[model samples]
Target: MPTAVYAGTPVTVTEEGFYLDPDQWREDMAPEIARDAGIDVLTDRHWQVIMHMRKEFAGKGTGPTVRALGRTSGVSIKELYLLFPKGPAKLAARIAGIPKPRGCI
Candidate 1:
């Protein structure tokens, strides 16, 4: 079955795209989505870090630095890099179900 639903209905498609239904997205769904995006194992700690980064971004109008994200999530910078090899803005925004970062558009 498709993961994305539209208007409270599941969408069927065979094309490659990023057409997700925000209402169908859940914090617990991040790992599978991330893995589908080529990410490896996503732990609960990863969710904590990513969600924190999202909240910080929403509150500050900007993404957090790795060091700051680490400090907030109580994880190390090295670990952050290990989890989000493409960087926080890329991985975190995707996990948070937020629009792609400004420069990415």
Candidate 2:
């Protein structure tokens, strides 16, 4: 385990960079995670996905996958890639302060 400062708070993280304890996450940390993931800005649409992911994670214990997100997030798959490019599910989970989707690499 390792600790890193995010949104001015020190939090534990795994070697993969996912937070060790989701309970310690703050909404303010989203921007920093987004920046690190190469997103310059988190628009309303981004917030839409991030919020949805967080909601799902709370109930499901794991976030949605790319296909699941496409079907349920009100955002299309192609747009999801454009919005959270490279790896939409992975990046969105990171920014949403949730564990990485079970099947995401």
Candidate 3:
């Protein structure tokens, strides 16, 4: 595990940089996390996916996959790619401060 600082707070993260504890996540840390994940800015559309991912994680104990996000996040798969160019579900989960979505690789 590694520790990352965002918004002046230290948070534990995995070797790949995903947060180790989702409870340590704060919405205020999102922008910095997004930048670290190669997303320069978080638009409203980005937030939609982030919030939906968090909601799904809270309900299901895991982040949604790209397919699930496309189907339920109100954002199309094409647009998701456009929004998070590094990788939609992966980067979204990173910025959301949640663990990487299952099957992201």
Residue-level lDDT of model 3, residues 1-105, one tens digit each, is 789999999999988889979999999999999888777888899999999999999999889888898899999999999999857888889889899777745
State the lDDT at 20 in candidate 3.
77
Pairs in steric clash, model 2? none
Question: In candidate 1, which residue pairs clash?
Answer: none
Alpha-carbon lDDT, every model = 0.61, 0.90, 0.90
Give the lDDT of residue 75 in candidate 3: 97
Clashing pairs in 3: none
Better of 1 and 2 by TM-score: 2
**Cα error of candidate 3 at position 65, Å:** 0.7
Cα miss at 97, model 3 (Å)? 0.9
Error of 1 at 102 (Å): 5.0
Model 2 CA lDDT for position 35? 93
Model 3, residue 75: distance off in Å is 0.1
